[model samples]
Target: MALDKQDLLFAGLMGSKAVNLIQNANIVNNELINRVLPVIPFLPVKNEKNNVTSKSGHAINAEDNWTTRDSIEDQKQFFPLSFSFKENGQKWLFPYEPMINIASGNSIVKRNVAKQGDKLIGTIKERWSRKDFDITVTGVLIGSIMQGKPEDCFPREHFSKLFEFLKHSKEIFIYCHPLDLISVNKVVVEDYSFPFTKGENVQAYELKLTSDYSYELLIKDDF
Candidate 1:
């Protein structure tokens, strides 16, 4: 069916999969962890291979018939998202976009090549390395409530979950989306930077992770 402008726009918006979620993270100490961040307003990167050079000369060296061959080579995927929070009478200013890293297996070619007719037949299958990813969540903390009193500006309890995670190691499930999940990943805090003033606010946060679950586990959730 031919699509109109409105249809195309809707597909672009919905099919883009702008929405993403992190189901739940491990608890460090007694502080609760943060989940759910906004996907940065940008296009998701996809590394794709449309064709491959023929290594086997089955067709008299006539280009080896590279028709219907493609693949995606990125084993790891990264995303930039926005996060903000208001707590302890202080509102943290989201200075810059935060990046979330996702690890995935590569797509592979599963075609049967006929040496006589130079024909290729089969399907492209995406191989998932694991369902779980050991992901470290980190972001920048630029500005906070400036007009508040000293006591209010600095809460009695600092947002120390990051520190707790650093000291206490734990594995938790992270929902990449509602149906998709990265489960039982060892999560930790790393590469934290002190706040610095820039045009907006700039600071850095980092997390370290590893996983054994498949990246596409959600597809088979029913089983």
Candidate 2:
């Protein structure tokens, strides 16, 4: 079968390579707020929400006050973003998008129900709570300490900020995507380990972050 020019162009558009360039990571220390991370490079981290936790169908009746009372909780819809930065007029893009793994930030809504003799009756109690995020970053770039290599790697000085953040216990706002940012109040380094290979430095990191109280998603034109 012969393909027309329009058909080839349509296929190309469908398979276009999309890139999410990271702009900056916002942070705060003492009086300094919205401080950007010194070391910026492209990282592969997918933004997604974890499975929600909920309880349903306590009672068979749907209309009864005591009927199936379920407490449902879920995180707001947000995308995880890979980090990226430019140095020396060169644009660095991450090859893989799954190297950095972010466990979803969880939030829950509580509900109350009461039942008397199989007929459930209870006043609804509503409450919301936001949880923290457990992030694991593993890739060649994270452990790369080589200087002058801006392609698919980062420097040791840049990685040092992770340790400094742990020591100072500073809070940071991660601009995961252009539309939204992961604002965390406390960043605790849970674990840091890596292996030394022949001419290769590979590292793994575990971090626990406290969720922010509030945030606003802004459009690029408005921001």
Candidate 3:
């Protein structure tokens, strides 16, 4: 069928408009993809709180991780990070966290001996007390040299900060893979030491920590 010039012109205009709309839609989609891609990698870690020994329902958000050294964007995602500590709006992360050894034992009391004169019957199991768990960690503070980074020096800053945690004597919200598996979350640093090691960029340290049980005490009214 033959069409008028006006009809042909109208059709061309409509096609142009449709093309512009499609172009705009593509631009928007690209922008959305760019924004969402970054967030996808940082969408936070799994929710594992079944083993929080400190308090009921204490949360440990693993997404609050960051690297100490700068690297390419592609490598940023690969930067090693293992341990996460968060408490009262403050967070502490080990950029290259490494737990060399983990030792755990429960504090328990088993009363097995009765008085010397008591009946020789099977030992009386009168007293039984199972306290908190003792957690020992042999952690390594990774520095530049280990990753072949620029410098070959120990991570003094991280070491100092870790000691700071021990000195403060505050209960910390800790998230660690091994500890998490056994439902351990909150902990208190009872002791720590930086043992001598032959590493220019790494320092080995030992930590004696105990599982923390948080409690609130009510006080009497004051005038």
Candidate with best TM-score = 3
Give the runs in model 3 whose Cα sits over 4 Å from its true position: 1-88, 100-121, 146-152, 216-223
| Candidate 3, run of 10 with poorest lDDT | 51-60
lDDT of 3 by residue, 1-223 (tens): 3444533432332233334444444445454334211211112243344221121111322233322231113233222223335554465655443333445544444456646464565555655555677876654565432223323235767777777667774677776656777676788888777765433444666778888766668768889
Q: What ranking of all candidate models by lDDT puts the best one first? A: 3, 2, 1
Residue lDDT tens for model 1, 1-223: 4555533432343233212221122222112112222121122232244322333322233242222111111222122221112112222222232345666554454554456353534543444333344354545432222122333222222234334434544433332331145333223333444333221212245556554333464564565
TM agreement with the true structure for every prediction? 0.30, 0.34, 0.47
TM-score of 2: 0.34
Task: Output the worst ten-in-a-row residue range by lDDT, candidate 2.
Answer: 65-74
User: Candidate 3 — number of clashing residue pairs?
Assistant: 1
Q: All models: lDDT?
A: 0.32, 0.33, 0.48
In candidate 3, which residue pairs clash?
51-183
Which has the higher lDDT value, candidate number 2 or candidate number 3? 3
Task: Name model 2 segments beyond 4 Å from true.
Answer: 1-115, 121-126, 142-155, 178-200, 214-223
Question: Hey, what RMSD does candidate 2 come out at?
Answer: 24.8
Q: Model 1 compared with the native: what TM-score? A: 0.30
lDDT of 2 by residue, 1-223 (tens): 4445533432232222111111111112211111211122122232234222222232322222111101111122123223322112222222222124556654656566645445656544476555666665443223322212333233354346445554544344343442244543223455654433222222333344433344568746754
